[model samples]
Target: MSTSIATSHTATPHKGLPPGPKGTWIGGNLSQIGPRRVDFFLMLAQTYGPIASFRAGRWRLFLVSDPELIQQVLVTDARSYIKHFGARTFKPVLGNGLVTSEGDFWLTQRRLLQPAFLKTQVLSYAPVMAELTEAMLAKWVPGTSVDIAFEFSALTSAIALKTLFGLDDHGDRVRVDESLRLTFELLTHRLDSLFQVPLVFPTPANLRLKRAIADVNAVIDGFIAQKQAAPPGNDLLSTMIAAQREDGTQMTAQQLRDEAMTLYLAGHETTALTLTWSWYLLSQHPDVEQKLVAEWQRVLGGRAARASDLSALTYTAAVINEAMRLYPPVYVIGREATTDLELGGYRVKKGYTILMSQWVNHRDPKYFPEPERFLPERWLDGLASRLPKFAYYPFGGGQRLCIGVHFALMEAAIVLATVGQQFKFTLAPDAVIDIMPQITMPPKYGMPATLTRR
Candidate 1:
């Protein structure tokens, strides 16, 4: 659980920097950190040891792979940091939502939205999660080839729509889906680009991004309007709509849209990736899949999964935990230092950005033996409890830990149990599994698989 790097590779007192790969005078590590950034971070950690420093353009970024160092950035010194610039790129799409907001406003929003994601509240949505999974499974035909990633994405999106806004209309779901896809794709492009043009500029990409944001905003606005016209409901949006601050002020209209969009994106995308990667891993390891199926058969006996059945599905949870360890949905989380500080014996300037990569930490050979292999059995022996908290953080950590952690885990388990009871997937002959590290790490090439009844 305690991963120690070579003391020799640790930060040295040379220009107050940690040991890292040297780069060009102008671009620094930016040019070298091409498309597959997850791999780049992994290389940084492996090559330079746990705490590595590099520059991306003008950004003084440190890749902190040490679990103790990660803990300091995410928990102990969390208040000294804010979300890095990469997160801010999606503000046009996310608005001032929880994911991007900072300081007192972020705290207030977190407190207001906390009730809806509480364990008891999240459990109330388990039936809906199972129902939606069943609906998806109802359409699956044995011997048919499908993109498993797309299937799970659509399924989780539907669950998000229904659970967040109480709207199950297919048209609205498709509209929001398309708009968000376009919006995220555009924002990702901007995030990768070296020179970002202001949104005010009428560049073609900016114009397209603007339209995409407006399209999604239109869908969200309509949902809000409908929710306002009707009686209050149990959905998250309704909760947000009714929530008032200690000063008796309610969230403004824009605030509602931002928070709703944040919840919708966070609620679905990561869970979708979790399930997607889980199926992919299950496809590769039949022995593991068989063990998972046996557990599901013993627990549910061909019935749909319920919230109460979660604790009984030990192997199922292990499979998810292991899959996330290998391909974490939110691969890397970055925090910008708000003031000059010392980390791992190196002076972190006010604007320095610290990146803790789950992609790197989760695979630490010290924590997980045979880290590259998909071994769900490793977690069956209470490994999670033994590992350093930040070493296996798929849901993140600290005060800003994902509010929907319980909800996502429950949904993943239920959906996995509900679907695994009936069908198992086999990867297509020519399927090329690769990581596409955007806001989340989804398969670069879609997961092509044929379904078969278990």
Candidate 2:
């Protein structure tokens, strides 16, 4: 779970820094942070100002809402920090994939994975997006409520798998869906305190996690070993397998397995969350929905959307950005300082944690007025131009920004555009959505929505 591979951290403290929430006897604000971590931080931002601190157990958690300090930590002095432990803890699940790992290895993996999703290359995958959306919509029954969140999770799962590994079997759809859903659910809870004990009795959660991981790993291992032996198409996975260093060293099978898991998880989860929230936002704002449909109708005219059409779907793109702003899939970006440094004239030492929550930053009135309202027009006319780059990083910032960002945006915009042209979704009557945070933000119990053919 160590972010920096168990290396000793280098963070210094400042003199008379801002006030923080005081700790109670045992847990401090750990329990208070609650299931709603994003809301918890936003409340702290309200109570403690832009820069505040709170105790999680004995750990001092600094809550940063200032863009300047975040820019310094993530970009200008990025090398002095690394991804936080929450991301690192998934290393067993993610391997040294782009989301996890540090130093040269992370760089190498990024390079290897980059080509598969180059801008030109990603555009070629648009047809797959269109096809997959249609395929999913074909199964929906009119007037029945479906969990659109679950629907998207499954949709993106299939899209990522097919686009990367070429799993196109109709019969395996249910199997694939179950494998990913179980893995997603297990990953969040399996690493908790109760399961951390060595040789402990298996709780139902533990048992479920063990079985789920075993199933997913077996499925992935089989596909990977098969691909390695036969060597198929030039998809993302194939490109990754073929990646070599200056010394001409390619990734080992184990590395390939790890990277595949990383891509699989990364490719689907965050993208699904983005699309899910987009659907929710669109349903709420009928005006935005009208404009979005107009754009789609003019662009596609009842035909399937291509990636090249992504630029023409500006509103669609803006809506995705706005949704990410309101409900960013990766709710936070954190780093552990390796060297003592002065940021915003405040001294912070090595090993000190600096966090910038999209939950807080995207809503700061200085950058976004009435940030809670789902308004995509705020992104038009280059309205977001004035803000610092790191001020809004749902996909993260810097060279470490998501490699699959183009893919996710293209997938979400294209699929939704194509499907929305054919069907309209309204929130299933009285469905209460609780945005749940785990490795990726998702609606708890899924966002049930009724679909109607338009």
Candidate 3:
């Protein structure tokens, strides 16, 4: 049903909470959400209004689909909220990292790490991103189908490891890649299962998670120790190692591990999924693909893309932006209310969860015209300035905005420019590209596509 019709019947102005779809007594909406929680969020927004409320388990969950309300949650009144419970689950793999840490410690960590992601610092890694994409392209064979999602996963992981940790050897790549895969799988299992055993119980799944976390921690710990002994390099690890507190001390060993794990996880998966969806979208829209390829050809002239060439590759960047809008890598961003407050005209009690799904907001017809259509040209104009601030938050917004935003965008643009002109990928026959939104919205069965040399 149209949102206007649904809201007319569902809008709760005052003396009550915002309206949401019906739920059961025990599970509430939890049982109905299933694996594709994105669908449930969309249903909530469409069937209710910009502000929708529901219950998940015992907690009251609020989905803020309006851009204005999102701004309050992410920026204006951000001090009143902390990271939500769902995000805390990542603590097992990420430790007290920036992604999982909060309050004063998180602020301190952000200050220490912010310089490493400065525009100048991120630009230095452009050649590394381009070089790795070139290496990946070299391994592909024409007319053979491959799981592009897996390929991008490995490609981005290698780049993250090499540029951030200064680990370039095949063995290092393999070791880190395996550990990350296992960690992600364990997290996915925990997220998908309704009932989860405690990690201390020594269940098979718990043991596997422990092993994966150990493997990753060992790799990071070794990097820290090595960096401490050697002369510092320009890599992120070295930068962090060189940073000191007010009392002239570097981060503690555990702090180092936490930050390293956080960056490693955040840096790779989002970019990989962004490119994966870009390829899928380009495959489906040959016209847009042709436009992107034409832009690459005109901009690079058969040469590999350099960081300087990024500004000229406008259409290529738009393709990536449009793809991300349709399938945001970090689909849902959640925060918990610290005190009782009013949001979008609804009374929200203390401790209520606030959810902002880019997948829902990015597709809102109010902000983005023809929300279902892939129109990169829409971004080529002044549309960005015309839209509300939080309407297109793929990298999130406010002080907590992704520190790696510039890095991921540059990496994606460079990869597209480097690979777009040399190859064309088409979806394999009968291969369905479905989204499985776990940590990031990865393709459910992997993106099986036929790669053709251009």
Which number leads on lDDT?
1
What lDDT does model 2 reach?
0.76
> What is the C-alpha lDDT profile of model 1 across 1-454, one tens digit per residue?
2356433214653456988889888778888898899888889888888888898877889999888888888888899999999998888888899999999999999988888889998999999999989988899999999999889989998998888788875777678888887787788878877788998999999899899889999988998898888898888888888888899999999999999989988989999999999998888888998898889889999999999999999999999999899999999999999987877777888999999999899888998989999998899898888988888999899999999999999999999999999998989999999987778877888999999988
Ranking by TM-score: 1, 3, 2
Model 2 steric clash total: 6
Worst ten in a row by lDDT for model 2: 1-10
Model 2 bad stretches (over 4 Å): 1-13, 169-208
Which is the better candidate, 2 or 3, if ranked by lDDT? 3
Q: What lDDT does candidate 3 reach at residue 14? A: 66
Could you tell me how far off, in angstroms, the CA of residue 391 lies in candidate 3 after the best superposition? 0.9
Encode model 3's per-residue lDDT on 379-452: one tens digit a residue: 99967788888889999999899999989999998887788878888899999878877778888889998988
Q: Whole-model Cα lDDT per candidate?
A: 0.88, 0.76, 0.84
Clashes of 1: 0
lDDT of 2 at 199: 22
Error of 2 at 196 (Å): 4.7
Clashing pairs in 2: 10-350, 11-349, 11-350, 11-351, 12-349, 12-350
Clashes by residue pair, model 1 = none
